[model samples]
Target chain A: MQSTPPGLFRASWLVARKDLAIEFRTRTAFFSTLVFALLGLTIFFFAWDPTTVAAIDLAPGVLWAIFAFSGLLGLQRSFGVEQADRAMDALLAAPLDREAVYLGKAVANLLFVGGVQLVTIPALALFYNVPLAGIALPLAGVALLAAIGLVAVGTLFSSMAVNTRLAELLLPMLSLPFFLPIVVSASMTTARLLAGRPAAEAWPWLRILLAFDLVFGVACTLLFPFTVEE
Target chain B: MPQQPAGPVAASPDDPVVEAEALARQFGARRAVDGVSFVLRAGECLALFGPNGAGKTTLLRLLAGLLAPSSGHCRVAGLGIRDGKLARAHVGLVSHASMLYGALSARENVEFAAKLYGMPDPAGAARDALRSMRVLDRAEAPVRSLSRGLQQRVSIARAIVHSPHVLLCDEPYTGLDELGSAALTEALAERRDSGAALLLVTHNLGEGLALATQAAIMRRGSFVRHENRSGVDAGTYAMEYRELVTLDA
Candidate 1:
């Protein structure tokens, strides 16, 4: 048997790697999230009549909305592959710690959401003619924070939704409510950056995002065992 | 594997792997596992037999530190079930669901589990375990492509990969064929020989009787009879089990 404490980090990383490898092979969550994000952006571009609206004014909301919808798409499929094939029980039975399972799922979600964000960023810049060069670094930081918080809550709720009869329907319903705070902070921060405001002006929203990320991340880590058991 | 000679039993119950006292789990007003108490030593196999809805699964979950008891306490390796992190290190479970990731192959599933338990050489350990279970040929196959019996075998391999001190299995024989069952029986016997306590819940009387050193029958929410294998034959045990359920009804 292995020793404790340090062994836990190894275990968590292994779990995350396994999930990433599987997702990389099938592209199940990745494709769905990417396509959904593109669709969301296209609809908003056409519906808002971006030709009339100032590109800067619409840029922040458009970016935040694309991420939010893409995240929902990824979260919906996060456990879908597991449930379709009945692998969740095997995972629950393994000697691994329950928190590792949460982390593994979270990492998988992050990659899929991040991949969508990577593609959507340049697309949004082109569609709205917003200057992407100025705010790239701060925008990346905000996006990372928002993704962590969103995936943290989504992963927790997805585990619960996967077991229910109405898994597809229930996941969004349960997840969207918990996401309001994250969406607000991310949108506020992005909006400020888009307006060419200095980093100091957006620091408050950054703080809120950091706080949400820490709390939800820890809570999901602790509560995962109860959610995944048979 | 060499067997140990019979020796004098220890007098003190200083560190039982499993200890449940007046444990009961109630869903609303319905008592699922009621007033159950038992202590499992390190080198014993305790079979739990009951019909559907008799709370056998619930009791097994309680012992595995997977569920909270409504009225009593369940301890594994001297740690409370509600202790979360501490208790999980001491217990492992095998249920009907595969609980694996289908997108990944069988090898990846085991390695992932090994990582969760903080095991070194997770891939090597997982490979050896699958080979032992005769599922090595399918190790690289996605779990979705495997048959139910093969999947169950992978589930068993995953359960024992970390070598937990207490093994909790609920209907582990559900999907196994005869050969698969024999291989599983041998694997479990090996674990028992290594001082790991086995707590199993099953509806198959023949398999339960064959694998258990001691067996208990549950009716409604409580155990109605408990006996060692030497004390009762299979025919008499099954008859008594049926009678007990009938009487309760």
Candidate 2:
């Protein structure tokens, strides 16, 4: 007798757990992302004249910039693991709904991107000498909203580019277009929040991020099955 | 003993766990699978022999629902492969690749499959599958750390964990040694005896013939020869196969 499949939520969680477990074991992608993030921040800090332009102004742009690039590193490796032995075929052949695969992968990517942000935000504050005394929670809130948008689009493109000859190159090339709106909105929101401006001042940019997240989140989940279907 | 060809019957059996009707797939302008068709009922095994690029893998993929057929349809347990979730629940595939996570332990890999299939006790199911494949001792070892043969056993364990009704295997014997081959043969036979319909694609004629109740020789994108195993003369089949393959070449 054949077994029934788990519900979409359970199946997606299982996939996400499997992915995070593998990432935890190797630490290849996560470590590289950290190294790249820290290295990128150090260079950005020194490249500009902090004396000429306030460090506070550069912090928001620098944080989001580093976050975007480093998040790409994580996204590129997301579906790459499934290619190790064509383990993806087993996943595709399973009885679970295809959206579960997308949701699981996107959730794992969200956590991955979120983890990188957790470290990079503190590093940004230290290197750029940007004060975070009263705005840390709002800063984290903006980062979470931005990450949802990033993972939604990045995970979809990652799945599409994984089987190509130049996956590393193809992923960024395809995803950067979709990521532009996210980065712009996030940086704008962060700038307002970092300036200790009224929460109302940042609402418009936050709305853009929220809209991008909602639209792409549902669209990517629907489109993901087509990318994996051959 | 000599045997005669048992040609295609006018009608299918009452219960066919796997059925492919006029299935075809095209790549660019090339027809990888050109209108191939067959049926296997409960407890039946069909060993398909073909040369490289003869469309055997494409056919299997189409039936396994990995690749959508450009035209035609196939079914598992009377459910169309394109019928979605429930249909896939009835099928398992073991391809040339191990299809396993290298960083995951053998036990973890099997358990992952069980959980995806919604088994109530994934850990127990995984342990049972590992023990059955004779890899229980290495359950905690990372798959990448194990030998190729051991990894293949784990792959099989993962594929069978859900107790699928139709099993598809492509070049399953690729890297096995004497002992590994024996173990695989035993496992496959056990599955067949338990009423799972099977489609096995292999280049190893002797091994395939040993387990096949039905057999087919594929060339290009079509079946050049097909018959029941009882109708074949084991001693002469190798020579006949060589001639057929050479003629096609």
TM-score of chain A of each: 0.92, 0.97
For candidate 2, lDDT tens digit of each residue in A40-151? 9999977989678887777778888888888999999999999989999999998889999999999999898888888888888888878886888888898899999999
Clashes of each: 10, 0
> Can you give the lDDT of residue B84 in candidate 1?
52
Hey, what RMSD does candidate 1 come out at? 4.0
- Candidate 1 chain A lowest-lDDT run of ten: A1-10
Weakest lDDT window of 10 consecutive positions for candidate 2 chain B: B1-10
Best by lDDT: 2
Best-fitting candidate, scored by DockQ: 2
Q: Candidate 2's C-alpha lDDT?
A: 0.87
* Model 1 complex DockQ against the native: 0.42
Give per-residue CA lDDT, model 1, range B1-249, as digits (tens): 211111122234446778889999999999999999888887788899987789998888777655678889987766676665656655667887877777778898887766565565677878877877789999999887898999989988887777777789889888999878887888888787887778988888888877787899988889888778678789988888888777756
